[model samples]
Target: MRVTEDGRGLQGSVAPTPPLQAVVWATGYGPAFDWIQVPVFDAAGEPRHQRGLTEAPGLAFLGLPWLHTRSSALMGGAGPDARYVVEALLKRT
Candidate 1:
């Protein structure tokens, strides 16, 4: 897959958005604590997780809200987010 960004959002045109085999809206049923409009996601546009940790065993989130700090969910705070993920993984065993 060819991927490039021009810094103005998407630089070049992309092929038509393909249809999904099965669209599973990952929008979690809202967070237990509401904070914003629309489903709040981490900087990766993925679902938010607590400390990047999931309830499922061996499963974890990488970048998510409140993983380490108030701003960790934003783009520049991935460091703490990553650390949290590692911790969660280690505890899974």
Candidate 2:
């Protein structure tokens, strides 16, 4: 993968490869939450929540690492957390 800065933003490109079965691109980083100008994060910049429900009424997080349980970041774990958050969202409206 090749990344270039185009003044306005960064552009990523991948060189052509022979018939591929799988491709995995790892950014080697974590999610950025600084852009969220809310009091939902803790001192370490991690979102503060309970079972995916944040202190902020309109804000909620899903599939985050250990958002509720050990498997919170796994695909199978997402279903339960997603359902919980969705239920909370529906109740809000």
Candidate 3:
């Protein structure tokens, strides 16, 4: 695979490889959380959630940008958001 001249895209050929062993994708943040799929996201690829509670049930995401406030992505904010998610999880149980 090679990157486009613009460096904003990938151009490659998909060919068969040996049988599955494991696959590792390292997409370190930046609106590219493609690994999290299904009903968890809306049409815009943003998580379908309220606060930290995701639509996938039981599963939740904490510390995402603007999760509940401008500081939601901060370390300090994770504690509070985690508490909220824990409460929500308890309620669901």
Candidate 4:
């Protein structure tokens, strides 16, 4: 498949293909987060964080894989990271 230069449509070659009623494109690119309207992420569009803690006060993330451990994205891994974030929040309070 080829993305349109305007980044709005796709083109592909498929034999005996029916007219597309709808198309859903899934790109593995990083999150846009453009709708966030916050100064949390860096220039790269990734949340500026250290172990799920962002520079913005009272802002934190969870369930990010490898945040602090290999399992950080898993339910079990979320516990430790949650504790850490909570601890930091408490300190600020």
Candidate 5:
């Protein structure tokens, strides 16, 4: 495989495209939940709630993007998510 730079002289590479069964992109979304009069999903393709605290009993979320910071949904933010879930659970009890 050879990688060629574009006109801008930036390094790039080209690899054979692999077949995909589905293409559910998680590119994130903008703030658009006004019309959604129900549980909403945040930028991480997960349900949006206050620190993963869902209205449903015993239901919560974690690792949602833009929750705590821009990296909340990332792998590094799982700890925070866990905390939120635990807190919510505690509140329920």
Candidate 6:
């Protein structure tokens, strides 16, 4: 289904079969690490790193677009990156 341009409701060829009781709209926007006490952002304010791996020791990132793959920001993408970061951290210890 497609959301109305005004965002009041969904606009589609067919109505929902079960009828619509509630709708949750999730939107995507740029990341804002303003509160982070780290120097990981670039001039554009995005993270300065390679595939979510920052140069800061013991610092790593996840759930970022193209972090490990094209789906890095998605649900399944965090697992592998998380594991890799964890292993690296363990090795440091």
The lDDT for every candidate, in the order shown, is: 0.44, 0.59, 0.59, 0.58, 0.48, 0.58
Candidate 4 lDDT (Cα, 0 to 1): 0.58
**Which tens-of-lDDT digit does each residue in 1-93 have in candidate 1?**
211232112122444234321111212323332222233355755555556554433444443456568766565676666665666576565
Please, what are the lDDT tens digits per residue for candidate 3 over residues 1-93? 333345343344663333322222222255565644335777777776788676554556776888788877877677777777778777775
Q: Show model 4 residue runs off by greater than 4 Å.
A: 1-32
* lDDT tens digits, residue span 13-84, model 5: 444334322111122344333322334455654565676665544445555576667777677766766766
- Displacement of residue 71 (Cα, Å) in model 4 is 0.6
Order the candidates by TM-score, highest first.
Answer: 2, 3, 6, 4, 5, 1
In model 5, which runs have C-alpha deviations exceeding 4 angstroms? 1-48
Q: 2 or 5: which has the higher lDDT?
A: 2
- Clashing pairs for predicted structure model 6, backbone only: none
Scored by lDDT, model 2 comes in at 0.59
Best by TM-score: 2
Per residue, candidate 6 scores C-alpha lDDT tens digits across 1-93 of 543455444456665234332321111355656545456678877777665556665456677788778777777676786677667656654
State each candidate's clash count. Answer: 0, 0, 0, 0, 0, 0
RMSD of each: 12.3, 10.8, 10.7, 13.1, 14.9, 14.2
Candidate 2 deviant stretches above 4 angstroms? 1-29
How many residue pairs in model 3 have overlapping backbones?
Answer: 0
Which of the two, 3 or 5, has more TM-score? 3
